[model samples]
Target: MIPGVSINEILTLTSILFFIGVYGFITRKNLISILISVELILNTSVINFVVINKYLYPELLQGMLYSIFIIAVAAAETALAVAIIINIYRRTGSVAVRETETMKH
Candidate 1:
């Protein structure tokens, strides 16, 4: 439709990626893997914004700006999450989600 690429194809890929991220988040028990899954989900949103903006409003930079903001937030989130995970691991000697079930020692 648009030269060589179609919006549907982009949406389809984004949907697949989103589901994969969801599956990873639901099935993974490890902290790092879950973090990666969250990143994947965030990335899909970024892709959708970029693609829609590119096709619908090539003159505006709103989508690119939003994607940049999301990337910044994701970076900050990953840093904070990693720091918290490390702190928990140091105290509990494990990074598994099940180990954080109780705050009691």
Candidate 2:
């Protein structure tokens, strides 16, 4: 069973996750790692949106709609990025960010 927690705890947890995502975004080099970080950031926003919608504006679907759109966009972004990375690897023979510089001119 989940422990009884307050709003403050939830917010703090979200904040920590957001920071972790930021750190991953800054420190990771692989395309997939950055994509996961982006999704993590989006998850934080979606959680906040749902919480506020449920508590502060119980009569509207705006937040839910926004969250849905964000999720869709994140999915599309990841798919497109992965496709590009695959193409890049097939042509260049490597996915490492540091090695893509040879084609930049």
Candidate 3:
């Protein structure tokens, strides 16, 4: 697909993206930044599914179905995370990662 691109190249790109997301998730202190990182991580899986299906299983729709499902779940997760982050900000005046621990009290 895409003229001459191979699955190995595509997978390599996804792996890089995934690791960047993981690094962001680990280093970010803001809740919104962490959410963005999580979204990025989820998107790599979606890309992998689509790429694999297009290159290896062109006869089946499983890849498309799985990608769609992942997108829907990611959307729902993003909405919920945003809502929770907003609530936390309203209560604590900060959306920092450490601030969330106060919610346990």
Name the top lDDT candidate: 3
TM-scores for all candidates: the values are 0.90, 0.84, 0.93
Q: Write the per-residue lDDT of candidate 1 for residues 11-79, one digit (tens) a residue.
A: 999999999999999999999999999999999999999998998889989998999999999999999
Higher-ranked by TM-score: 1 or 3: 3
Better-scoring candidate (TM-score), 2 or 3: 3
The CA root-mean-square deviation of candidate 2, after full C-alpha superposition on the true structure, stands at: 2.7
Candidates in order have lDDT scores of: 0.93, 0.82, 0.94
* Best candidate, TM-score: 3
Give me the displacement of residue 8 in model 1, in angstroms. Answer: 0.9
Alpha carbon deviation, residue 27, candidate 1 (Å): 1.2
Q: Where in model 3 is the C-alpha error above 4 Å?
A: 103-105
The TM-score measured for candidate 3 stands at 0.93
lDDT of 3 by residue, 6-92 (tens): 999999999999999999999999999999999999999999999999999999989989999999999999999899888988998
